[model samples]
Target: MRKFPFLLTVATIPAAIPAAATAQPVQSLDQVEETVLADDADDADDADATGEVEAITVTATGLFTRIENTGQAVTVIGRDEIEAVQGADITRVLARAPGVAFSRNGPPGAFTGVRVRGGEAEQLLVLIDGVRVADPASPSGGFDFGTLTTGTVGKIDLLRGSNSTIWGSDAIAGVLDISTRGRSGLAGSVEYGARDTLFASATGGLSEDAYFAGLAASFFRTDGFSSAAAGTEADGSEQFTLGGSVFVDLTDQLELFANTRYANSDIDIDGFPAPSYTLGDTSETQETEQLSGALGLAYYGQDLTLRASYALADTARDNFDPALGAAPLFTSDGNSQNLSLRGEYRLIGGLTLAFGGNREWSEYQTDSDTGEDATITGAYVQAGWVLGGLAAHVGARVDDHDRFGSATSFGGDVSYRVGGGWRLRASVGEGFKAPTLYQLYSPYGNLDLQPEQSTSADFGVEHGVRGSDFHAALTLFRRDSENLIGFDNATFTYANIARARAQGIEAELGVDLAPSLRLAGVYSLVDTENRETDNELARRPRHSATLFADWQTPLGLVIGGDLRLVGDSFDNAANTVRLEGYEVFDLRASYPFGDGVELFGRVENVFDEEYQTAAGYGSPGRGAFLGVRAQM
Candidate 1:
């Protein structure tokens, strides 16, 4: 495979461009979620220590918008929340969101799948910085969350429901946008946990008026438990991660920025023997490497803002089995490159016009399967309006694929303030997912397969207590999907042979009981069925909820706890195999010690409930971890 030249180009952009601008501090979790509804009457009295109204730019909308003005069901997870949870992986952190669910095959570092609103894993799009990270080699063209670590990630924006009008294919469910840390400072952490798990990370950077640069690195290793329920042999994994960003202000209104992240992991796995589906004594090892990065230039004018970016996501995997001799089992590589240009211009009063274009190239190679490549080009336009207490957004996109011809998607959302601290919103959108290269060119592929399409709608209401710290929201959503691709048992070939219907309700509440205490919770009820067979879709729970509380003491001590509940679901399409429901509890504590230092500890799965997200797979039991962090 040829090396990607764009990465090297991105690394050199900062050095080439000079910079000048006032340094902006990182946004806090609450500030990042600030609503568009301003409290003019209380602004003077409610000023922060800095005496400035807290606000942030939300990127989930393609065109940046204020959080409160965003008509979609969006959730923001900041660095503070990430640190408070003490999660070992990204999946654990994401599971706390309202309409998100995940199933892991085994221990950490194993193949993991995440679903949004009862949609399949592949239907959801994952983005880091601005680059799509789906793996073309995977059967579903989905990203494996097991490889994502929380150490370098600074913020996450989860947009639930169909967003293909703004984003493109594979956004039938939603989009997970992750932004890495880019603040100037020095920080590091070291941790040790059960099963001989060890983790360490360090980050440092400089964000001054002239230029900004940030870099972070992390290492993790663990002697994990068995992957299968019947296996005793330990399956361990190790990972190394490096990420960084650089920005240079060429002028007051123009800037150049580049960001990159690379991760490499080796995992020991268990496999089934000849006839049984249970774990056997066979030993296998898989190595995976992923590199993603983006380079962009932005211009902020008086009434117009423009950005152009080039990004790439590359992944490679190789497997080996000692029991099958020294030779390798199989190897695969996948790559996707994207170039995009977007701009926003102030139109008439209270209105903005947004437009963008994107071109993406995807390629896949495997030792056993056929190698193929494809390209896609798309363009989109949107209109955004904000007047008094009403906000509205409408967008449309047209995509041309090399193999599948063309597809068009459109969406619109409206929100209106009903009364004091109350708002009502409604949205309707359409999405589509094109067939992957493997589904079209491989041996089991069907060249005549059509793209999967979906139509979704949602209605929601939100209320925030005036002059208080309480907020609540309720949303009901429905999705109708057709031409779903699945494998046929009788013919042993891939084909588009299914349709699905999914509907769900999501509710969330947050309260600040006191200056030192906070509480939050979310609940979701989903109903998904296969339209062809009238059977419940596999691996989708009907009910799920999470509750969390945190408190800070005068002595610089912080304490928190989380309770997660996952309802029952089926493991197969026939609905004959049942997976029982389960609940898990976790506790965390942290105390500031010397200057710029803190000590923290957490206990996960306190009761050690035995549960399986996937049939025959083992979930982690009760475990404890301790760590310390320092910053300068």
Candidate 2:
């Protein structure tokens, strides 16, 4: 027998002003310079209002196409939007996106988890400069948002829903594609804040007719508050990051490029007894290092393009206990390598075809667990068509894994404009996640576990007021997952014995009231349940919403505020431990000085509302920061 649970419907008023345009002038997030022959020139004038732009997106289909023309639910966050939020970490910035839910154990450097549409953290795929960077050694094979900062990032594109047919592997939920800064210029910033926190960064780049190079580096340190509730001892953290990119134009049609990023951090933490909420006296230290690099070449023809790339990611972590002497308690190392070839050709009329193949190899080793390795090879092909106000896409992929044998996935979507600023779209996709190396080879592993599989669908409608600054969208989505891997209490081993269903509605609105004032809002209502026990998924909020506003004054001053709300959720799978939800308010202001200089300040948790994303963990209270920035 199967059961479908329904959730209460909540009414929310739409607020206006696109969050992406709050920091700068009003512009469509999807707008891109049309360089391809298939671009629609007639609709260029209405791009801003309709959320349609000429920008090219590679993640949607492994080929460059207009973001508005792609039949997928997507959002783009550019540099301006990033700076406008003025967040110290990537998790804070990402939380502003619709349908995104995140939880952190404690402060900025603590372990963090992100999920989309009630999916597990590991189900989402993360790419930095086209290189996969998830830590295979981690229990969930997921990327830690705590280690990432936005100082070197130029743009981010988030594609929601099952996209494994194009991204493969862990893309059972969605894909987060990040691009580093590659333009010419020099920029830097210095900041000081509460808790004796200090941050500084420098970035420089050069772009010539045929050659370009860019570099960025940053340092951060803070004497943070306690990680555990009712604890007096304070934990601290420090991190250093460096990134660089280089591009060479070998010929009019051929180019070569490379990108590299490295991050290192040291953090202090508190310990807790098993199954208890009380904080223990044991103090611990953690050291982490991450590196990612990619090198690629591309040959561009009149109507055809070909590309080849190689990428690598490595991560290591060591934990130590001062009370137990100098010997490390545990250590882990993980690495991944990928080689890919892809091409795109323009067909007759407004049709395009894209195909790609990839080979992936990964390994994980831990001091307490035996090491493991695995390899996978995959190939995919997709077709896209765009004519006037109508767009369509279809793609399929097959992966051959050393342990799981083979699996195939497919997806398709269609979008159409119905005139008078209305657009309708729908999509259905299939995705799969292979068992991680740890889940397959560890002492508690299960060799006979089957890979997790899912089917997801979404229907949406959008309206943009012509000749005005108002845009809104409503989306309905559902996902069904089977063969979910979980620990078996009786056997003390992992097994694929659970199933889940998630359904939700997402609403968003943006409006610019005047040239200097803007407002944006997002709301999501989700209902997720585990089929085996007929209970709600742990730590997933049923309701979440955000409201943001920005104002630019005549005196060259900019002010912004954000209000965020999260509903209650359970902390345990049995739905026995309830966690209370909370709301937080934040404010920021910036003043421009002469000669490319500016002064900025921010206040976080303005009301000092005490809250926790994890039970027994302490979330930050009211805090303030001041900074200066300069660019050329």
Which stretches of model 2 miss by more than 4 angstroms?
1-56, 273-278, 464-468
Model 2 Cα displacement at 431 (Å)? Answer: 1.2
Error of 2 at 479 (Å): 0.7
* Model 1's TM-score against the true structure: 0.91
Using lDDT as the measure, the top candidate is 1
- The weakest ten consecutive residues by lDDT in model 2 span 4-13
* Per-residue C-alpha lDDT of model 2 across residues 267-305, encoded as one tens digit per residue: 888887457747743489899999998787766565566
